[model samples]
Target: MNVFGMGLPEMALIMVIALLVFGPKKLPEIGRSLGKAIRGFQDASKEFENQFKLEAQQIEQGLNTPTPSESEKIAPKEVATAEVATAESNNHATTSSQQS
Candidate 1:
């Protein structure tokens, strides 16, 4: 079977070389460690992918929802009217005192 672009013959050659270099006694231990390493890497990658997706969803929701500033924009005219009325009253009081 194809694995990392290496066919059956290539896999066999690599196994033979490893066996010759490391010997039979140490090979099983090495294989077990290698399997554990690969499993850990896969778990970490999946965790990172899930975390990324969750953050992206949160960001999307934040963008879609309206903020306080956006709601304030709709009622600014009433605030402006109140400000104008207060200013006019202040101007009238000042003029009346000056005339007296």
Candidate 2:
């Protein structure tokens, strides 16, 4: 609804006031400090996000794994073999019944 969320006249007035209050000598210093603070905040936030992601990944892997201190793992191949053995026994029983 307004330029820069403020009236153009209001922005000009604020600029004039800031120029008078801080003067040319201090505005550059203020800008520099503000830039540094923004950069530091960005760096810190990125580091926090990276750490959180790493912790989440570690938790996921932990949930998917069986360690030496935990229960033994069941491999897919072993499961498949067990299933095949059960099916073979069932077939043999049916074949023997048919023969008899």
Candidate 3:
């Protein structure tokens, strides 16, 4: 069996090494520490995920909230002129493409 892509032989070898180094009595204590470390990592990861999700939601909400730009506060005539200029440039591109 592969545990997180570790083959059975690899796992067995690791266990054997651990047994030799720690002995049976200390193995349980090491295992407990390992379990706690894994759990702590999982908890921290979850909290980080939750925080990112919260920030994303806040950003989505801000996008929906209308904030008037400087242009929006400007005169309508200026906006119309800008739109016409953009449309002319777009038309020019389209004509160039069609000719090609």
Top-lDDT candidate index: 1
Q: In terms of TM-score, how similar is model 2 to the real structure?
A: 0.53
lDDT of 2 by residue, 35-90 (tens): 99999999999999999999999999999996654223556667889999999999
Tens-place lDDT per residue, model 1, 22-88, is 9999999999999999999999999999999999999999999977786588679888899999999
Task: Please give the RMSD of candidate 1 to the true structure.
Answer: 5.2
Task: Please give the range of 10 consecutive residues that has the lowest summed lDDT in model 1.
Answer: 66-75
Q: TM-score of each candidate?
A: 0.71, 0.53, 0.64
Give the top-scoring candidate (TM-score). 1
In order, the Cα lDDT scores of the candidates are: 0.96, 0.88, 0.95
CA deviation > 4 Å runs, candidate 3: 68-100
**Tens digits of per-residue lDDT for model 3 on 1-100?**
7689999999999999999999999999999999999999999999999999999999999999999887777868797899999999999999999999
**Residue 4, candidate 3: how far off, in angstroms?**
4.1
Checking candidate 3 for backbone clashes, the offending pairs are none
lDDT of 3 at 7: 98
Candidate 2: segments with Cα more than 4 A from true spot: 1-15, 67-100
Candidate 3 overall Cα lDDT vs. reference? 0.95
